[model samples]
Target chain A: MQQSQAPISSSSAVNRRGLRPRLTLLLGGILGIILLLDLEPYATRWLQPGGDIIFWDLHFPRVFAAAIGGIALSWSGLMMQTLFRNPLAGPFLIGITPGATFGVALVTYLGASMGLEDSGTSFALQPLAALGGAMLVLSIQLLLQKKLTQLHSLLLVGLVLGYFFGAAVDIITQTAQAQQVKQFVMWGMGGFDRVLPSQLILLGSSALIGLLILLYHRHAFNAYLLGDIHVESAGKSVKNLRLWLIIGSASMAAIVTAYCGPVSFVGLIAPHLSRKIQGTESHGPNILTSAFAGAALTLTADLLANQLIPNTVLPINAILSIIGAPVVIFMLARKD
Target chain B: MKTQRVLSAITTLSALILGLASCGEHPRDANKSDIVWIKNAYATLFRVGYSGTDSFLELYTDAQSKKIAGAFHWGTSAAIQGYEKLKDRSKIVSLSAIHTGMLAELNAHRHLVGVESRKYIAHPLLQEKSTINSLSEVAPDGPILPEKLAFCNPTLMFGTLSSIEDKQAIERQAKGKFSVLWCNNHLENHPLGRAEWIIAFGWVMGKAEKAQGQFNTVKKDYESLVVEAKKSAGTHPKVITNCVYNGMWFVPQYSSYVSQFIRDAGGEPITAENGTGSNVVNIEKAVGLFSEADIWINTDLCTTLNCLKSSDPRVQHIKAFRNGKAYHFNKQLQANGSNPYWDMGCIYPNRILSDLFHIFRDDLPTDSTYYYDICK
Candidate 1:
């Protein structure tokens, strides 16, 4: 057991390099908070135990939900990208968001439910339907994982399923009157403000628990990036790692989609931005950085949404596309 | 680089929504056949129509408006044709300002450019449009030109399909790439159902929150009046509604909002059932229902028993006409034969509800009645 001194030095250097991502995370958090508080009735009136109704109820919940949404989506994206060994793997791309959207379309189109609170022993079935839809798609993908075997086939199936669910949503919208199925289409438009103040608890706790699971297993996630043979040779259960990855990402993505509608660009763009900043494939730093970057991007888009026209909040999803689309196009079209 | 190529591929794939489903039959028309929920007021309150595009992107790219609320009144006509959300305040034309008080909103339309107001306005709106346009023209757009935004008034009850100027303007503006804002309040047969139309008006006026508040207050007052009237010591009047016009007596059905108003006001309404709109009765049934009546309402043609006698000498046997308790919603009748009751009445159902309450029980000051008038 001759320990190479070079390995020791490399490990120390890695710890020192970790400081950059931590600093970046701090800055990102600061930016997100500042943006959240920057809007009108602008002041920290939200701290006064219900001073301003606008701040206490509307803006704070929306901004906080948006931050959590960014983190969850980016973390979900990181998990998918690393697991698939592709930067493009996002929760939306693999049919999860579309599946949740499909559930929303069905719920709203049928007029079966829309968050009836006073009906004791009842909960809003809309979010649950969305969660169930995401899980259904993930379970199907997982089953296909056993049969498809190849990673490319898994990705392809995900792509096809995404389109399939999207069309299901399309058919749903087409069938229902524009007025009858208003909420059905509203789900697809994706809004941070759509998260109910009551749901903030479930959304926050569920997202945090999922993130903790990811953070706790970041080592196994890193091992997962080394491929099945490499992961097994490294004394890790590849199947277990892959299962956790799918479960963790699916739960977070499903939860966020259930709350925030179907957000885009945050997840797909976050990991790439993190990798650009950190320049490492290590899961621990990348996960933290990706979450921060996603939060920052989402908060920035939210800021633009509020400020775009006076007294109007543009759709957060549309703003994200306007920002993320160009960034992605630039990255793809770039020489390096 | 490999990253660049992979990233580009991902970007293209990310933008794809995979919209390849077989179209489904429009269910809005089927909502009428629903029979149960269709009668529920909220079901017809608002709707977001599709039929315009697979996605609402048909307007998304051109207009900077968001479809915050789809203010639709599901009527007895065909399915609503387009997806229309009036962009808040900024896009509302001034002609319709008197009803929704949109002159306050005229300040938001900076680049009102030119409004193709010729067909969109009847005489009342035309009177208001010139003043509104001059006031709305000063705002500057950095790069944008004036848009051909047309205003629609669906208040003309005698107007076809609850929307006239809009359908005509739609054809003309469709060529010029203009847009129209619509309200179908006339289709809502309930007074409050008509009044809830303010929420859509508020959306266009940039005071949707305020409209909702006003409506909530009105609803609260109306419901409270109903509760109060329940405690009053009075026998429930057997109320017959409407007069015979063109050899048929059309009365508000049991399911009609007018019937709901009468019932809510402590009156036992003599009416038909299992339908919306109005119920048509043959002469025999009409005479039979009216013979049992203790009160009569919604008579438009008769102000006096002699007038009622002249229209139909059969009025001599009517219980309400003999008792002198007959009422008509002709108080808001203007000099031009166009009544404000149809337009302004829907904006304040509490008033109408109160009027009926007073007619049935006599609590409110008689002179305070805004829509209903007692038959002398």
Candidate 2:
């Protein structure tokens, strides 16, 4: 699976790869320690013995979900950027997260209109709603790609769809009651700590499965990076590969968004960080490196958001944007 | 590509199916005349109210409902309207926010199921509606779910009908056959006018005479409190409200009902210069207001001064915080976070006024506050 247009010599590339994985492991260890030790005054019970209910119910799920969700979103972002050959492309930048948002809006608003806004059943099915919304956008993108020759044009379609879904969400928010609107707004702000203990395993497994699929097709991604001509000459249908990649990436985003809300930074920033650190376009190393980096960033962000105020939990998305926006700009500037 | 098309088509179809499924409404069935209505505060803002066999009551529209919902004294407008309209007000089985002004009325009718705050729960006169049946032991953990309310099996649901959850419950249980009176009480700007919602409540319950009579006493008591507050010629304490939630500070507008209480209690309220609704400002601006203010109220459910300070240490710099004049509207709370101060506080602005007057004036012998507790 070695690239024909490789920039670095084989020996140097191998040595760099060996060093990057160790750095990633070190970063992951430091992040894990930060997350575990940075408990708020009220969350002290999380570390005490016989705190199973507290740990399993209140704490572990959130930390695990944040790490897993970050890995999934970063992995998806890598797949998206590689497939589109566009550095800026990520799930949230396109319509995938918005599609998930739309699905939640559908359930929330439609339920509100029918006078069932506060029903437990409505909240219980949020993951399904998110998945449906995500699938809707993914399907549209797949269908449109068949006719449109340019991938950048496809990016335009995703942006437009994002706006359409966003508008729909706003309209429904206006019609819904104050409490219901508040719930939706909180969900939109995005947080990792919202996942329930019951949902942790399901979300973790889905993310793991998505990560495995990406790992298996690491060679395919390398071939696609070489361009569609290379991939076609290798007897792989570029069209089918693109479709599968979209599905895989969109599914990861949708699942994480459904469980933990629409996180921003991991999907867009982590992949860039991976490529920068690895200094190569190889999917194998970049994929693992991005996942580890994404997890570290998210865990650290979640810790800050949780403990920034003594009693109040600040929105995770707000903290992520504060962190992610500058990183993206810096990357663009450095690339420039 | 063929496989991709097939999968894409399937995904679209699945989205449509889910969309349609979510659009489904819970089936409701009930006879309007046979059911009684229970209401939350927000639902009282609409013009129309409940429908019964003998009447389709238009709450805010009718001259009587309008007059009472306009009045600030709890049950006063209802009492006045009941005398003119000649209806029994006692049949209105609505949850009362138990406060001083309505204590007499509520005590007189022990059948009424009131949502008492923790302070009022200990009141000697707290109504003992058939303890086995009248009281809903299932305290709803969050916003009143339809099921918790369904236990009441209300025939005439009185509210603004704005909450989709409440609407669905009524729809499913009553099957579009029950009466849902729109109570637009929150819309009334006049302190007395906001209290007059009892007239609408009276009409629903067929207890006009009792509602009117009860409201008259509240009017008299509330007027006397106002008269007492008017005697304070000293400087009006600069008042601020609410603490930060999720890093944003929300202060009520000058036109807000809470500000009206501050004004009536002889205190100057700090509000946003513009906007008729709550103003969302950053922490720095909110802290500036807090530091400058003489008194702070409604510290976002922070019952203790320590809770307030711990949430934001900058609050310690406020004059109100140093003077121990910071108060919370959470004088009464349930373990589940339900506070009747919200439910009944609107019905008795005079009590809230009395509470604020006590908080602001050092000259006056401190009166027992009904809805506020000094955060210390």
Candidate 3:
């Protein structure tokens, strides 16, 4: 039996391919519905004191703040993975979270007696301190690049810095008053719930700037993906591209770390999920997908966390750890 | 000239002999008038098996010994009873009254020289007259500043079991400066010990007869109340005494002074099984033990009805909560105007028993009036 393909059937195959855009729009619409339904009223009631219109207006900024945080962290994850060629890299791995934690602890435990006016200011400045701390480590790694050939050295350095910062935090917490320590412990639980409305502007603006920088350098990102030697052989400046990528990633990491606390695993896992879903090695699709997925995942997890106990809310990190750890493990297993 | 000089010398010699003779006569006269007899009032009043009825006669007889310049009363209720007995005989120049209302009796307005703490130093009269000093601040290591104490020249010091620990320090501080007396009204250190100490204070104040009468009255009243409580004991409801700290509930253990109040009131204490320690137990354990108890008594300083209403939330969970059976201790009974309640009420367990019996025992023939008023 012989089968003959008709010219009309070939044209229908092209039309079916054209329907992919509508399918994507439908999938996005469903996810957007889930996000809007899960987040809006619940976040509104949880953060704002009263159901008054004025209070709801005040709560709007925090919603946008978290949205901005989700985008920045996802984009930062994408940039770091592209630059480092490592899927497990994120703000926490680079010692940024611990560094920021240490800054907050120092101010909380020691600053009051030292006559610091605003204790929360120290917490707000943590990301700046963390950026410096991460850069210092990064610079040290760069300096030792000739001496240390293994990527494990950089990872080990980051680990040691994290432990060192952690020990410093412990010392600060030990001398703190019982009540103050309890508060610090609660904040350390890591959630978007603590972000104030006023911080939205700063978080949103920095995230926008970082996204624009990454978008503008999209060609350089593609060049670097082919390897530094190949890009340099193609007559593009690999060193300049690497520098810009690191700066962009570091800034994005710092902004998110400052506002939303260290949202562990989202930065590491979201990019990988995006790459797998897109089934393409292209950075543009990966970036867009990762941003959407990260926001969706964070919003969904936060929703589940809020709903778990009827009146009481658990930390967002606890939920993320449960969901994120398993997905990352599965992905790694599949890659192997 | 020689004859004139001899006349002058003779006159001078005669004047000197007359002066010596007058001086000798003056000594004899002074001995007769000023040598008053010294009295041992305490020893006479507190003699073995001595009753409190003859306290007045003992005090009057002791008055003939010497004018009592000052007196130190340190015994708890015994001091109050002793002061009342000797109020006419002695001008109580200085006193260290520990109980709340006991200071009101001194009537020496503003004469209170020292206090245990700021929380306990709210007397209007004492506030005007005395410079407040905390017992801890003045005598952290003991031998309370005798010089500071000497300024007031307190002849007597009154204290409860709580102050018993500082007795030696007080005495050392008062050595040669003042006398220290022990008041055992709480009887907490001993069940029947407080009434006996009243006799001792009476003897010290030379009011043995008056102390004996007061002691007899209290003893008789307590015995009758105990009998009444025992009669209706079976109908007495079980009670849990507690206060809130942070979010946790602190239940009184079996052996606390509060437990005695509960038991004497004819109610069984829920924590009675723990056996008389004052350590606060956890809420879970307390709830487990007293979940079925008929009443929850908030023994905190809830002086008013309003204050009792605003008490900690944990109070709402007890069975007593559903029935509104919670009772707060009235603060009015803290002291009799110038006397310490700890010395008086704390030492005299019978009075506390009577109050508790009135509150808890149904159909008990106890005084219905609360000795202390709830703050409200």
Candidate 4:
């Protein structure tokens, strides 16, 4: 119980506490799985062209992408919120999304200047460019997070960096050709459909390892809340802990942005919803709850985007906004 | 005499291209040549109600969404009520290069003074004009600015309902100086229907006879080619088109113009599972269709086999890629990404159909005259 109350090592490893929170995660996960299984865009038995490819190659990879994305964004949001002790804190606040967007736009501009076909296979390189951009900008924030004595300075810097990257994206949009701009816009819409069958291994394993490390050191994130000295006192290498935390959040945001494009609102809304739903002071349920919430919300949004119309695949961002804004508004309105 | 002259010219071209007789079909033989009637042979989105040279033209669009998108009209006919009047046709602003190409096909090139997408204009005539290059991209969120369009001093503007700019909003912005006519030439289900939009463009440009003449010759050429393509020996290859762009794999629908060409060319074309406009699917479904294909066409932006492999590594296993059967229509693409395949290809469906036909057949030469070529 003392370990449970401590800043690191939750004893959440084998504890039977937080039943409702645990159940919420389990049910949310189950619901997510069910929704993913049902995603068959081609109404007929056309999927029978390849044996269970509809599941293995198509839906499986897509579901893996969404789940991983959800976990990454939601966990990153939780980390940001806890470190800042602010409810409004999210991954996008650190300028990761904007930086990633700018990177994608920059690549489009370069390609256009090189006179490459605007809407062609050349877009295959966008994922790499986006990942590189997200990491570069995020690393600056993380380095400052380590160097700066105060969280407020880091927060202010992130806010400013968000603006900087935003202006950069806007500049690119203005100069690029209409066809080239259309490519960036399409990439911004974000979807799980972009994930390939081959990418599941890397994304899935990384997400699993991240989840396990967090689960085993259940109270480690709470120590992250207390900063570097506390993590060192709790028999953990402060440097390693800091590195892990920064890398985890940065990698999650970058990988999701690169593979699935910038999925907005999931990172911002999930942690807040998790805190409200968990209804407890213990940070033990915070990571798992928010990660589950993120996965469930994103999966539902994707399902709705696919099935809302007869044969149309609407943009995921549009559907997420529709689903997320209402939940956020209701939670705020209730203040329950 | 004019009809005879046009027919004679067409006969000569048909004889040169297909080496077959096309004189068997003639509209003037059945109807009075002096009546001056222009009818659409295959277009479904466009309907001409009257028989006279100056008649009401009805445009069909999306009506179910309650956005007020279907069946509009513009003409001088006072008899037809609820139709918008397009008073002046001296100058025109084409939003799409396809329309500009169609107008040029009718020898009404003088009417196209403004265009929203001047960069896409790959026609040598328009590209060499030099003044056409100055038609800047004017719209911020949509396709046109009223002030910029006003600067062009155009009488008619051809717009599409698909853009973010609403038709009513454009009508308000253009005011009386110009009228906005919504054209959905790309949305046509049949290849000939898309080509037949030239006739409507002709009517607007006061070149109805010229448009009809061009449409008739092409239609005859297309049908004859379809029949000739069917006569070739051996089985037609399984055909798939287009590569992934921005995560979505778009293919031609079964009833689409692309599929009709494949069917006519004696080849099997993999079609979208559903939908009419922009057949989109994820990679999984597309891969299922792609693997079954023996030949690929319209591979998006891949000018070479190396480019195709880079777009999707799975193409390496696709029979088309392995056999060097992958092809694209960017043969005449310029440094600025202006491919006449889309510009002129819309006006000449027969040329593309012939290209596909010859490519699909093993005995014939694979190299196309224009538009399509092998991605070596």
Best-fitting candidate, scored by TM-score: 4
The ten-residue window of minimal lDDT in model 1 chain B covers B54-63
Model 4, C-alpha of A309: deviation from truth (Å):
6.1
Q: Is candidate 2 or candidate 3 better by TM-score?
A: 2
Off by over 4 Å in 4: A1-25, A28-60, A115-121, A143-153, A174-182, A196-247, A268-281, A285-315, B1-38, B47-56, B62-87, B129-142, B162-169, B233-236
DockQ winner between candidates 2 and 4 = 4
Candidate 4 residue lDDT tens string, A1-336:
333664433344326345665667675867667554555443345446554655565666777687777877887766566656566777677777888888888887886576454334456778888888888887897777678767678778878888999998888887676657867887898988878877766666656665665676557656656666666677786545555655666677777888788898887788877665566434677777887888887887777776677445778899988887897788778865
**In CAPRI terms, where does candidate 3 land?**
incorrect
- Write model 1 residue lDDT over B158-255, tens digit each, in one string: 11122354445444544423334444444455667666655544544445567667777878888898898788827998898877532245677776
TM-score of model 2 relative to the true fold? 0.52
Number of the candidate with higher TM-score, 1 or 2: 2
Best candidate, lDDT-wise? 4
DockQ of each: 0.00, 0.02, 0.02, 0.28
Off by over 4 Å in 2: A1-18, A38-50, B1-344, B347-376
Sort by TM-score, top down from the best? 4, 2, 1, 3
Candidate 2 C-alpha error for residue B161, in Å: 25
Between prediction 3 and prediction 4, the one with superior DockQ is 4
Chain A TM-scores, one per candidate? 0.85, 0.91, 0.81, 0.84
Give the TM-score of each candidate. 0.48, 0.52, 0.45, 0.80
> After superposition, which runs of candidate 3 have C-alpha atoms over 4 Å from their true positions?
A1-27, A39-58, A115-153, B1-376
lDDT of 4 by residue, B99-124 (tens): 88887777776777777666677877
Best DockQ goes to which candidate? 4
State the number of backbone clashes in model 3. 49
